[model samples]
Target: MSFFSVKGLSKHFGGLVANNSIDLDVEKGEIRGVIGPNGAGKTTFFNVVSGFYTPTSGTVEFKGKVISGLHSSKIAKLGAVRTFQRAALFPEFTVLENVIIARHLNADTSLLNAIFRHNTKAEAGNLARSKEIIEFLGLKDEQDNLALNLSHGHQRVLGVAMALATEPELLMLDEPVAGMNSSEKAVMVGLIKKIRDTWGITVLLVEHDMKTVMSLCDKITVLDFGEKLAEGLPEEIINNDKVIEAYLGADDIVA
Candidate 1:
């Protein structure tokens, strides 16, 4: 079985069907990209697969375990975690502090342990992990700076660091390079590759930046009107006539 699989997935809101019979398979340690035009239900697919929204009909399996209908937190605890398009951070907190807080998701401290200071060891471990993640994302210099003080690109990278603090096996990134300048996008693309290559995390990416997606993903899935329109290697996806007509403008596909 694929490391992550979505079968016959569908989601609806009132009369609108946001997703219809979508199927996907992602192998272990692969970087998979999902792309489409706006309102094509790409984010909706991510929401459902990540447990932010329950599928109206269908199943999502991770490592052969059914995850459909599970709560978002439950799915996260099972090792699949997702980052949002917008950077979610504690704006008032330092970059390191923000990641340490996120690490609490994996920390094993109880109220009593905290109240009596028995959680010191766990806190220390979390702090170490947070620092490692910050350095991994090239944010070591900004570790002591408040999250709001970082540049927009740094803030987005910080968001990824926070997610990594949870030690997720499958990381779902939504528009990881959104709003980034060319340099920032390059840094993020490298970080993502490192996350998969160095850390062995499987990535499911939803991105609009064609260049980034094409370069980073091992395989690409194209969606249109809430359905799977095409799936192939980047070269094939870029050339598929339907994909070109539906989403990737003729001028947008690089040779």
Candidate 2:
């Protein structure tokens, strides 16, 4: 079995079909990008596969088990975790505190114990891992700062760090570098590569930046109007007529 795969996945909203029989796969330690024009069901696919929404039909498999009907938390506990398009953080908390809260998901302590601040080894472990993840994402300098005080780029990376705090085998990122400027985007690109190379974490992302997708992904999947239009290497996807028409209407998705 593949590390992660969606077979004949479809999502329906009343009379409208957002995704229709989309089949996709991501291998271990590979960076896979999913791209298409707006309203092409990219968001729907992500939600279904990540268990934010149960699919109307078909299955989502992760690490050789069927995870289609599981809740988002359950899926996350099983090591497939996702981040939102926006940086979802506790703005009142410090950077380290935010990640430590996320790390509590894997803690063996009860909510009461966590809330009252137990001095157990488990709590210490969570703090240690949270610090590790914060440093891994290059947010060590911002560790003591309030989440709301960080720049947009740092906030986005914080979101990713929270996801990594779950110790996910497959990290599903939604537009990881969406609103950043060139330099920030470059830093994010390098970090993403490092995440895969150093941690062996497979990444599956939905992004609008064609340049980033082409450069960062090992393979690309194109979705058009709720169906698979094309799937191949970044070079092939850039040159495909179908992908070109879907994004630019006249030029390539990479153009």
Candidate 3:
């Protein structure tokens, strides 16, 4: 069985059907890209996987266990995490502190233990682990800076770092490189590969940058009007006539 699977997934609001019986499978350590124009329900799909929205119908299985309808915190504890398009870091907090807080999700220390001063070991461990995460995300030099003080690219990096601190087996990123400059985009591309190569984590990315998606993703799923239009490797997707028509108004090939 695939490490993660979504079968017959669906969601609806009033008379609007946002998602209709979508089936997606993500194997371990694969970088999958989901692309579409506005209102394609790509983000909505991510929300469903991340526990932001409970699917109206269908099942989501992770690690051979069903996770559909679980609370967000419950789902997160199952090792699935997501980063939003907008940075969710606390602007007033230092960059290092922001990531440290994220790492708290997995901390073994308990509030009661802290009250009895029995969490010294756990506390020390967290400090060391958070430091490692800071360095891993390339924020070692900016650790002391406030989150908002960092450049836009750095802020996005920090968000990814924070999500990594969750130690998720499946990581979903929403437009991680949106609004970044060419240099920043390059850095993000490298970071994505590094995360997958170094940590063996599965990644699900929703992005509009076709070049980046094609280069980074092992598999691509295309959506239009909340429906799946195509699914294949980057090369096949790029060459498919139906895929081209979905993106390029009308074909000028015959004209």
Candidate 4:
């Protein structure tokens, strides 16, 4: 079985069918990209797979376990975590503090342990892990800075760091390189590759930037109007006639 699989997934809001029987399979330790034009249900697919929305029909399975209809927090605890298109951070907190707080998802500290200060060892471990993640994402210099004080690009990176703090087996990134200059985009792409290579985590990303998606993903899935349009290697996806026709002049796919 694939490391992650979605079968016949669909989501509907009254008469608007946002997703229509979509199927996707991602292998372990691979970087997979999902792309589509605006309102194509790409984010909706991510939402369903990451448990932000229960599918109207069908199933999402991870490591052979069914995860459909599960709550977002429950799915996260099972090792699938997602980052938002907009960076989510504790704006008033330092970068280190933000990540440390995220690490609490995996800490499993009991209230009694916390009251007796018996969780000091776990707190120290979380700190060490947070620092390592900060350095891994090239945010070591910004560790002591308040999240709101960081540049937009850095804020995005911090969002990723927080996701990593969860120690997820599958990391789902929602437009991790959006709204960045070329340099910032390059840094994020490299960090994503490092996350997969160094940590052996599987990555599934939804992105609109064709260049970034093509360069980073091992395989690509194309969506159009809430349905699967195409799926293949980057070279094949770029050349697909249907994909071109669907997104031509509407998106930057050809370029």
Please give the CA lDDT of all the candidate structures.
Answer: 0.90, 0.88, 0.85, 0.90
List clashing residue pairs in candidate 1.
Answer: none
Clashes of 3: 0
How many clashes would you count in candidate 2?
A: 0
- Compared with the true structure, model 1 gives a TM-score of 0.94
TM-score of each: 0.94, 0.95, 0.92, 0.95
Model 2, global lDDT = 0.88
Superposed model 2: Cα runs more than 4 Å off = 111-115, 248-255
Worst 10-residue stretch by lDDT in candidate 3?
246-255
Give the runs in model 3 whose Cα sits over 4 Å from its true position. Answer: 106-119, 248-255
Q: After superposition, how far is residue 21 of candidate 3 from its true place, in Å?
A: 0.7
Model 2 scores a TM of 0.95
Encode model 1's per-residue lDDT on 70-186: one tens digit a residue.
999889889999999899999998998888777775555553443344657776676677899999999999999999999999999999998998899999999998888999999
Residue-level lDDT tens digits of model 4 in 160-242: 99999999999999999888999999999999999999999999999988889988999999899999999999999889999
What stretches of model 1 exceed 4 Å from their correct place?
110-119, 250-255
Instruction: Point to the candidate with the largest TM-score.
Output: 2
